[model samples]
Target: MWLDAVDGYRHLTPESLKAAMPRCPRPVAWARALDDAIEFWGVTDIAMLLAQVGHESADLTRLVESLHYSAERLMAVWPSRFETYARASQFAGYPEKLANEVYGGRLGNIEPGDGWRFRGRGPLQLTGRYNYTAFATAIDDDAPIKTPQLVAEPIYGALSACWYFVTRVTPRASIEVATREINGGLIGLADRRRRYEQASRALEA
Candidate 1:
C-alpha cells in the first residue's frame, strides 16, 4: 500500500498540484521538500507526507492564505523579543500576528517561558518550543531556534517536521499523529486517527 502511494506521488507534477492549490507558488518546492525528507529519513512512503500537508493546508490554498505575506517580508519585520505586533497593515487586530507570535515567534507570547509552547510551522506544522529547539539543534546550530523565518526554507521546514514525526510519534503512525501534534492536541487523537486512515488510503492509492 505504501509503495503504491509513493509511486503515485513520484508521478505527481507541479501542474496538477497547482491546479489543486493555485495560491501556493511553491508546489515544486513543497514536493522536493517531501521527497528529500523521505529519502533522508528512510521513510518509505512520500505520499503519506504529501497527504498530511494537503490535509493540514486544505490543499495549499488555505495554507498560502495563512502565510499572507512573502517569507522575506515577514522576516524583514519580525519582532525580536516579547512584544505585541500587528498581523499586517492591511489586516486588523493582530490575530494573524498573534498566531505567528505564538507558533513562530522567538518565544511564544501565550506560553511565556514555557519551552513547550511552540505552535504551527512547516509542512507538517511542527509545534512546541521544545520541539522547535530540538529541530534547530539537530539541523543547524546557526538556524534560528525560535522563529518562523527558519521554516521559510522548504527543506529545513520539512526535515524539522519529519524529525519530529519519526522521533516523537509512532514509526507506523499515520499523518493523523502529525496533524494532532501540529494542532497542539486541539483536535482529539481519535479524530486525527480517522483522518490518518483516510489520508493514508488516499496517498496509497
Candidate 2:
C-alpha cells in the first residue's frame, strides 16, 4: 500500500498535484519539477516524502494553507520559527529558539545568522540561505530562491527541497539526518519515518 501510494504520488500530474495542494495553479510545471527532483535525488519512497509533508504541514489541507507564491510569504507565515524570532532580539539568540522549539534544541546553537545555518523552507522545509541559493543555482532560474514563496511554489518548492536533500544532506545520511534537516532535528523525524515506513509497507502489501 505504501509503495503503491509512493508510486502513485511519483506519477501525479500537475492537475493532481494542484488538487493535492491548497492553492492549485493552472500549470503542471510545479508537478513536473517535483517529480524530476525526486527522480534526481533517487528518492524511491514517494510515500515517505508525502508522509513527511503531511506531518510537517499538519495534514494536506493545512499544508495548502501554508503555501505562498514566494519566499517572503512563506517566511511571514511560517509559524514555527516566527515564535522563536519574535522572542529573540538578535541573530545570536536565534539558535536558542531554533534549538528549543524547532530542533528540540538538540543541534545546539544552529540557527539563522549563526553558523550551522540553513534551516527550513519549501515542501521539505529547507533551512538556510546557503542551501536555498544552492537549490536556486541547481534549478537555474530567475526566481528569488531565498524567499518562501518560491519554496512554496508547488513544483519549485518540491524541487528545492529535494535538491537540498539529495545534494546537501547526502544519500548516506540516515533518515535521522534528513529528518533533522527537514524537521529541525528533533524527535518528530523518527515517528514520521516510522509512519512513512508503515505507509510504504501498506502500499507494497
Candidate 3:
C-alpha cells in the first residue's frame, strides 16, 4: 500500500504500525496519513518520526496536551515560573491558568486566553500561536489558525507532526537531535528512545 511507495519505509505496513502503537485507534488511517505526510514533506527517517509521534501522543492515545498538574509537578515542570510550592499552588490543578501563566506573553499569545486556546494539539503537540500560524501558512490553510482543534484529527495530526519533524528536525537527524527539536529539551528521552527502538524493530520485522 502507501508504505511501499516510501523509499525506506516499505516495511512499515499497517500491521507493523499497530504493533508499534498498540493503543492507536486507527492504524490504517495513521498509515495513510503518514504516507501522505512523508511524500508532502520529503521525510527520510520514518522510524524516528514514528518514535517521536508515538511518544508525544502516548502511542496515539492523547491528541491534546494535558496541562493538569499538581503543585509539585508545576514547580518541577516550570521551575522559573513556579519558583516555589506556594507559587505553584496558585495555579495547581488549573490547566487554563497554568497554560496562561506559562505560555502567555510569549509564543505570539499576547491576547488574553490565547494560551489555553493555543495549547499543544496534534500528534506532535503543536503549541503556541506562532507555531499554529506558521504551520497554517506552510500548509496554505487558515483552518489551523481559525480551528486549531482540527490539528487533533488523525489526518491533520499526522501531517502537523510530520511538518514539525521535517521543518524543525532534519529528516535524517539522530533520535537525540529530533527529540530536542520537538521537545525543546530531553524530557522523557529514555521513553522516547525506547519507543524509537521498538518502532525500528517493528518496522524492520
Candidate 4:
C-alpha cells in the first residue's frame, strides 16, 4: 500500500480509510486515489485532509455543488446578493439562474455561461474560471479547464481536494484554521471538528 511509504500514515489500509468515511461509495478507489494525491502533493496531514473532504463532500458522496436553495437559504447564504425575500425568491429553485446571479462577473467568469458551467465541483467544490485554470496548470493538464466536471470523478476529485489543501489552506494545524481558510468562515465548525477527531482516531486504529 502507498501509505506504507509515508511516516505517520503507514497504518492506513483501504479498510481503515473506509472505516473513517463510512458513506464513501467507492472506498477502494478513494483509498488508492487518496494515496496517489497525498504522495504527489506531499501532504503530511492526512487526518485533516480526510476531515476536510468528509465535511465538504459528505465523504465524496456530493462531488458537485447543489445550487438549489429556498428563498430563506439563499438570503442567508448570500445576504449581500439576495437582499430581500422577493429578490431571493426569483432565483430560488432555479440553480442556473442562482449560480449566474451569484458567481457571474467575478472569479474570472466574464463569459456568458461561465458561472453555471464552472459552478463548484469536486470534493473541495472547485469553483470559478480562475481556479479551474490554475488547477489545470497544477495538474499539467487542460482537462480541468476544458471539462470542469471531470473534477467530480473520484480520482480527480481526490487529487483536486488534496491540491487545494496543500496550496491554498494556510496554517492548517487545526480544524478551525483549515475551515476558515477553505470556507472563508467557520460555517460548519462543529461538524468539521467532529470529523477531524474521527479521522485522527481512525488513522491510529
Q: Pick the candidate with the highest TM-score.
A: 4
Give the clashing pairs for model 1: 118-128, 118-129
| Residue pairs with backbone overlap in model 4 | none
lDDT of each: 0.52, 0.51, 0.84, 0.84
Compose the digit string of candidate 1's lDDT tens values, residues 103-161.
Answer: 55344334553332344566566655656677777666536464545664566766765
Q: Could you arrange the candidates by TM-score from highest to lowest?
A: 4, 3, 1, 2
lDDT of 2 at 132: 57
lDDT, candidate 3, 1-205, per-residue tens: 2233444433356788898888889888787777677777777878898889998898888999889999999878788888888899999889998888899999999889989999999999999999999998988888888998989987678778889988889657777888899888998899889988888888878
Query: For model 3, what is the alpha-carbon lDDT of residue 119?
Result: 96
Number of the candidate with higher lDDT, 1 or 4: 4
lDDT of 2 by residue, 1-205 (tens): 0012243345545554543443434336555666666776676556556556656654333322222123333245454554454333332334434333444323332444422233444566655455556666776764634354566666666676566556545354566666676666666776677756654554454
TM-score of 4: 0.90
Superposed on all Cα atoms, the candidates' RMSDs to the truth, in angstroms, are: 9.2, 10.0, 3.5, 3.4
**TM-score for candidate 2:** 0.50
Instruction: Give me the overall lDDT of model 2.
Output: 0.51
TM-score of 1: 0.53
In model 3, how many backbone clashes occur? 0
Off by over 4 Å in 2: 1-33, 60-120, 146-148, 168-174, 202-205
Q: How many backbone clashes does candidate 4 have?
A: 0
**CA shift of 98, model 2, Å:** 13
lDDT, residue 20, model 1 = 37
